[model samples]
Target: MTRTILTEAGAQTAPSGDALWLSAADALRITGWELKPEGMCRGELCVPLPAGMAKDGQIDLAAFWGHIGAPLAHDAGGTVWSLGTAASERRQSLETLEAPDFTLPDLAGAAHSLSDLRGKKTLLVTWASW
Candidate 1:
């Protein structure tokens, strides 16, 4: 059986277990992290993984996710996981006091993005189902 891996970007199907054991390709597809001899790397950022973290040449998804300070949550069966942004990244975003850029249609059906008004005083009104 395979577990459903969910991230803000998208969802992926990965091997199921108490923890996910992923091949290098699967890791990249799901989390954009590459398991290398030196560490888990994404582009120029290389995070030195601890010894034995990649046993049998497979990356432990849960271990590496938590190791990088991201919060991971799964169901009782540990078959569905939701990976959140890393704490440091979240903190940095918060420090900026800026909402993430998004696009939406206006009354005239014109598409506009928050980023388009980066310098202007833009008021965003949002409502959600809680």
Candidate 2:
């Protein structure tokens, strides 16, 4: 059986094993990272995994997530899990302190650019009835 993991990026299914381990490939698919000899790498970034986190070709998912300061939550039945954004990403967002520029349309269908509000005190509010 496989466990379904829900992440902010999307959902992925990882092979199930004991209580703590997940296949390296499955873990990578869910986390966008691979456990290399150097470390857990995604693109050009690599964060070294502590000793014993990887064993017998599988990763200790809980320990790996904890080491990177990413939170994980599972349902009571252990059939589903949620992985939160890594601490590094959150730290980078805080360091930059700049919101990504985006464009959205108004009720009349006129598009507005966030950059247009630069240097002005703007209060942007959005609501959904759902």
Candidate 3:
């Protein structure tokens, strides 16, 4: 059977016959990381998996995510699963409530610093013509 796995990035279909485990390939596609001999790897980042996270070559989705402190939820029927942002991301957001200061050019090429508007209530709108 297939289950719908939802993440902040988007959703994807994953093979989940038991609704609790996902094949290595399916899990990799859904999570953007692959379980390897070294660990779970994405690009150059590798997070070592705790022992027993992978069994019979299938990953216990819930346990794997939980091990990394990522939040996950599943529907009552287990047909849909949602993966929340990593705990580290959430912690970073909460730690810094203020937007980072940056400089950007205006229509006429005049640069403006976000810090300059710190004392005033400002509404900034940005658009891209693409």
Per-residue lDDT tens digits for candidate 2, residues 1-130, read 7788888766788766665588788878787789889988989989888888888778888888888788888888786888897778787887897865667778999988899989997776778999
How good is model 1 by TM-score? 0.75
In model 3, state the lDDT of residue 32: 79
Global lDDT for candidate 2?
0.81
Reference-based lDDT, each prediction? 0.83, 0.81, 0.82
The list of candidate 1 runs beyond 4 A from truth reads 16-18, 96-99, 102-121
Residue-by-residue lDDT tens digits, candidate 3, 1-130: 6789998657888765786588888888888778899888878978888877887878887887887788999999998999987879777987897775678777899988999998898787777889
Tens-digit lDDT string for candidate 1 (1-130): 7999999766889875556777777889888888888899999989998876787768887888888989999888778889988878988988998788767778899988789887788777878789
Error of 1 at 59 (Å): 0.2
For model 3, state the Cα shift of residue 59 in Å: 0.9
Cα lDDT of candidate 1 equals: 0.83
